[model samples]
Structures are given as C-alpha cells and as structure tokens.
Target: MPGKPVNTATKNERKLNFWERLYLPEVLKGLGWSIRKIWKEPSYTFQYPEEQWYPSDNYRGRPVLVQEEGKTRCVSCNLCARACPPMAISMESREIDGPKEREPVWFEIDMLRCIYCGFCEEVCPEEAIVMSKEYDLTFQDREEAIFGLDRLLVPKERLADRLAFLRKQQNPQFGSTWEYPRENNRHSLRDLTTDAESIQTEQ
Candidate 1:
C-alpha cells in the first residue's frame, strides 16, 4: 500500500490554464474564419431571374389544403378542427349539393394566433391539410393573415407538382387521386441559392 497510502491531489485537481480560461484565442479563430468566408465567396447568392431557394424536404410550415375540381380539401370529418392546439382553424363541413361527399363550407386559419405546431396536419385522415415549407409568408394586416377556405384551397395537381415524392410517401388509399408521376427531381432548399443579387444591387 505504499503508493495508495495517502492521496496528495485535491478533488479539484484538474484546472484550466491561462489560455484555456481566457478563451480569447478561440473567439479570434472563429471571427477570422467567418471573415475569410465573406472574402472567399464574392458572388454566391442567386440572381432572381436565374435561380431561387428550393423549399425544405420535410419542412412543416404554412398550412394548405388540396382542392380538386368542385371539391374542398376538408371532408367534414372535423378532425383538423378538433385537433387544433390554438383553435386557430375553423371549419364547417356541409353537404356539397349531395349529402354523400361532404366538404368544408367554411374554413379559416388565424395565422396570427396559429402556433404552427402541425397538429392539424397530423390529425387529418384525408391528408387534405398540410403545412407548406414556405415560411416567408407575410401579411399586411391581421385579417389578411387569417386564410379563408378560398385562399387555403390548393389544387391537387398543383400540390402534386410541388412535392413529387409526396404521393409515394403517403398512404395509397388515403392518397390524393390527383397525383401524377413523380417529377423525379427531389432537391433540398439548402442546396439552392437565394435571389441575393437583386438585394445586393443598388436600391
């Protein structure tokens, strides 16, 4: 027990040296790296006419519903309405000429109050409601942000075109029949360049 007879080191034996404690060098290194990037890439942003930022692959943002010919996306099930966290979504499903296929007579989403939790999209059985990847959505007034049935309604063909892999990933039975073949061109929004040339140019 010669070596273990006594413990000379204290509990706080490990301590940072002057350089480690200061951390000034690390901060300078990071600043230098960022400055180098700005200098390295002079013309990295897109020119509006030439390019644009692609939306995210699995982003859940703005709410939209697929509308077909003479049909609203909602099926009067009231799932989305019931599942809303902030109760921002309002829907009234009524008979669409025929009692068989019910559609939303009244639909409005209060974007100002909407928390964007994607709860409505998850609860939708018909997959009618979904959060779009577009997050730059702006509104001049609070009322304008409150999207109505007419504004929220998106043609199935348009949605299908926007999200090529959407059909393949969704349930076949619950899938929107308005689907066409995949565009076969799935790209991440991060990979695309934003239209910065216009902003960079003179006012």
Candidate 2:
C-alpha cells in the first residue's frame, strides 16, 4: 500500500485569491497586454506580390542542378537521391563518352514531396546540386510541380552566389592543404596513365 500522497504545492505555491480564482481578471489582463503590444510594435508585413523579399545566403529554398557551359556538372553518383528524406528526387543514369563517363539521362524532383531540408545539397560531392533562394513556388497541378532536367538545370553564372556561399561555409579548418584538383574531377581511366608511365620508368 502507498503512503498518503504528498501535497507538493502546499509550502511552495501561493493560494490564489478569490478574484484570481475566477480567472476573468487574468484574461482581461492578457487582453490589455496584447492591445498595448499591438499599439506599440510596428508591423513587419510585406506587400507580398507587389514587393518581393530576397532571402539571405544561408536560407534553404528549392534544390537545382548546376549547369556548366552547355552540360550538367552532375556525375549521377546518386548521393543526393539517397540522402533525400522524402524520396522526392529520382534520376536515370547513362554512360557517356567523356571524362565524366556517367551522367543522368533523366533527372526529376517532385516539389510536392520535397521538404526543402537541404540534405540533397549537403551530400552532393560534385557540387552539382544546391539550394536556391527561390521560395515563392506556384503550381496548378501535380504534373507541373514535378521539375525535369530542363527546369532543374540552372546556369553556373546564375547560381554563383549560392556556390560561393557553399564553398566559404564548407571550407575545412586545414585551409587549402587538401584542396581537390580540377583534373581529378574527371572519372576516366586517363587519371591512371601518369602513374602507369612512372611505374614503367622505375621498373
């Protein structure tokens, strides 16, 4: 059997007066405070459609693929698709005759399912995907919400700000000690050619 329940509030808590117990006075007090706040504080509401608001660099918005020259920067590593929590991203890859042999033949992202979490941007090793500052999205149908490669691809010049911000924020503490070489960006067997030649000379 349990001992008598303790009145934990007996000593610490103050008993409410008759008017306080009615609660009407407290409600009025809260209303008065709100009215005072409304009278004192200036409104921050935007005119919206007429006047657009641009977000800062750190703001996470819609994800877009980086287009370099006439081609995409993505090697179709599937890292972004795997990292997305909602599984909104999908792509089909194909082999191509280039240094970056693998490329996404078809890439699409369903904006309806996207949570704007930025996980896709975080996991892209090639810096192919990044969060843009475009927040105001309107769609009439589900089909329109699904963005294909044509809609997803943003020119590098247009995304320069976001790319620069990512580079600055993701820079390692060791500085440029381990900076990746541009030549290594290629995924071709030609990378091993130099090593093979050096080994042959040594042997």
Candidate 3:
C-alpha cells in the first residue's frame, strides 16, 4: 500500500467473456439444476409454520427465557445487559415471598436492536438464557418485535429439546454465578428457581 504497487495484470486483462459478462447462461444453468433437484426432492420447499427448516450451526436466532425446574437461571444480575453491545436487553427484578435467587418480574429483549452475538448466553453465570436455532422471527407489529419474558419463554416441549441439545454443547460448569448442570437434565420449576418447586404461569 505504501509503494506505487506491483501490477501483475492490467485492468482490461481481468475482464470476463461475452457469456460470463451477460451472466444469463450461468444463472440459467443454476436454475435448471435447482429446478430439477427440487422436482426430485420436494422436501427442499419447507412447509413453514408446520415444518421449519433446520437451522444453521452458527445461526443465533430467538432468545429463550428458560425456567429450569420452575425457576429462571437469571439472578437479576444484569450481566446480560452489561454484556449486550446493542443494549437490547431490558429487565426488572422483584423478590418473591419465599427464598429464591432474585427473579426477573419483567424481562424484555428488543430483537430489532439485538446483535445476536451469543454474549448473553456465554456470559450467563446460571445458563438461564440460550439462543434458539429457529431464525424465522417475523412479526406483524413492531410491539410484537420486543420479546417479553412470556414471549421469550420457549414452549415446554421445545425447551425440553433445546435443553437436551445444549447438553451436547458443553462448557465448564459455571461456578462464578451458579452451578450449571453438566448433562442439561430437566429441572422442575421448583428445582430451577422458586421454593414452591413448581409455579405455573399462564402461557
């Protein structure tokens, strides 16, 4: 970059051929292959809502507001808020009557501003938060875009699957914040956070 620089080839010499310049031939060839493959395997066109596509390994999608056993892993530490570069996380905490780690009475995540960098999940002392693989997060309204604790809580069945999946994605058990399970075993709500052992919220 400092010197006048070396020119191995001239600009005119780096040009494409007539067909390549036009680009139609290549496009058509790819289309032809795709059409034939789709015809052969109709499975490619996903039946969305009913059947979702397999998410990518690196795809950081929706945030799941996990309640292990019956408690959220988040201790109202605001570590995730500190960790988020985008300031997408907003949470409020309150102490319940019985003994338990502080819980987020109101937890909200602004997906529009989220970087999905997986920082919250990594920095989590309790492993209470995780990024769901499903990325098709579309909403009809802007208000819906801001995922609240209820909206973020993955359905019971999905949570079960995600917990099982996370067991495979291992890391050193967290001690700085709380003891995270190595096997990602199911903890009842009572086992997770609250003393009641199981507190049901209207989902």
Measured by lDDT, the strongest candidate is 2
RMSD of 1: 18.7
Clashing pairs in 1: none
Q: TM-score for all predictions?
A: 0.57, 0.67, 0.57
Cα lDDT computed for each candidate against the true fold: 0.72, 0.90, 0.73
Tell how far residue 32 is off in model 3, in angstroms. 8.3
Candidate 1 structure quality by residue, lDDT tens digits, 1-203 = 45664757788789878876689987898899999999887777777547766766567678888787857657777777777888898877777665447877788999887888888876676778877766767899988999998788887776664355554666565655545443322223432333334446645
lDDT, residue 6, model 2: 78
- True lDDT of residue 164, candidate 3: 62
Better of 1 and 2 by TM-score: 2
Candidate of highest TM-score:
2
lDDT of 2 at 12: 72
In order of listing, the candidates' clash counts read 0, 0, 7
Worst 10 residues of 2 by lDDT: 182-191
Per-residue lDDT tens digits for candidate 2, residues 51-130, read 88989888898999999998899999888888899999999999989799999999999999999999999878899999
